[model samples]
Target chain A: EPEVTQTPSHQVTQMGQEVILRCVPISNHLYFYWYRQILGQKVEFLVSFYNNEISEKSEIFDDQFSVERPDGSNFTLKIRSTKLEDSAMYFCASSGQGVTYEQYFGPGTRLTVT
Target chain B: AQRVTQPEKLLSVFKGAPVELKCNYSYSGSPELFWYVQYSRQRLQLLLRHISRESIKGFTADLNKGETSFHLKKPFAQEEDSAMYYCALSGRGSARQLTFGSGTQLTVLP
Candidate 1:
């Protein structure tokens, strides 16, 4: 089965540096999303992207966070000035059209800011 | 606001025993519910959705709107069923962003 794929399974960055997490969602899917999970915490939604624009975002997805579909296959999330609290497992998901379709998740990228 | 609650942090059952994982949601509008499972060293994957109303791998879940719950159940559990299960909900829209619960780790002991 085709699955969502993410790059840089694990990343370590300085507190003030910028980090970009990349994901390649299923080719035919139209909707994409980004979620994060702090260690020992529930998964939290960050943002959703469709048609090269953001559909919705949470409070956690502030000005420091940005998402881009620079190409047809690549979706990337960039965090400027990463904070210690920003360390978490970031997951990317995609789903086909329909209200009942299930979203498929990627393996996730573990971001560690020190 | 939409929220999902999975009260049990951990649950264990012996092989061949029945299993149930509880989930509850709070949403003003009609919401979509789903169960996602992640095995050790594997990525999170969809197990079942309320809309399908079908069983997968001998497991089934009923969406109880009256109780505001969607509990996953299996009559006879197997060792392979051990994994982390999450209850999630999405509001009625195109965003399709999910709000997930803390999750329940189920261990099926042999």
Candidate 2:
């Protein structure tokens, strides 16, 4: 079974610094999403990307956050200026074109903004 | 707005014991429900979806539309069932992004 893959399993950065999390979704998948879970909190949806544009985003996805599918296989999330509250486990997920509801998740990247 | 609530923060049961994790949602329109499980150091994996109505790894969940609840149940939970379970909901049509609950940490003791 093909699985979503993320790079830099753990990231530590100073407050106000920029950070970018990278993911490579499963081949042939079209719908991509970004979610985050603060320690001991529920997983919160950030944004969803499809056809090279943002399909939907939650209120939590503010101007500081941006997502890009720079290449055919690579999807990335960039935080312009990190805050301490931004520290969380960031997960990348994807689903096939037909079955967009069934998402496959990557082993999240743990971001720590100190 | 959409919201998912998993009432139990933690639950434990001995091996082979029946287990249930409660979930409720607040959505105006028709919604799709799903249960995702995450084991130690593993990525979140889909356990079951309300639309499918199929059992996976001895677990089943029935969506009660009237009550706006979709609770996960297992007749006999094994030790390997210990994991964090999240109940998620998504609205139909274009807005399909998931809204997840706080998640329940289930420990199946041996």
Best by lDDT: 1
Model 1 has an lDDT value of 0.95
Write down the lDDT that model 2 would get. 0.94
* lDDT of the candidates, in the order given: 0.95, 0.94
Residue B83 in candidate 2 has what lDDT? 99
Model 2 misplacement above 4 A: none
Best by DockQ: 1
What DockQ results do all the predictions give, each relative to the true complex?
0.91, 0.85
In model 1, which regions exceed 4 Å deviation? none
Candidate 1, B1-110: lDDT as tens digits: 88899999999999999999999999998998999999998999999999989899999999999999999999999999999999999898888889999999999999
What TM-scores do the predictions have?
A: 0.98, 0.98
Would you list the clashing residue pairs of candidate 1?
A: none
Q: TM-score of model 1, chain A?
A: 0.97
Please write out the lDDT profile of model 2 over residues A7-44, one tens digit for every residue.
89999999999999999999888899999999989999
Q: Give the TM-score comparing model 2 with the true structure, all chains together.
A: 0.98
| lDDT of each residue in A1-114, candidate 1, tens digit only | 899999999999999999999999999998999999999999999999999999999999999999999989999999999999999999999988875357899999999999
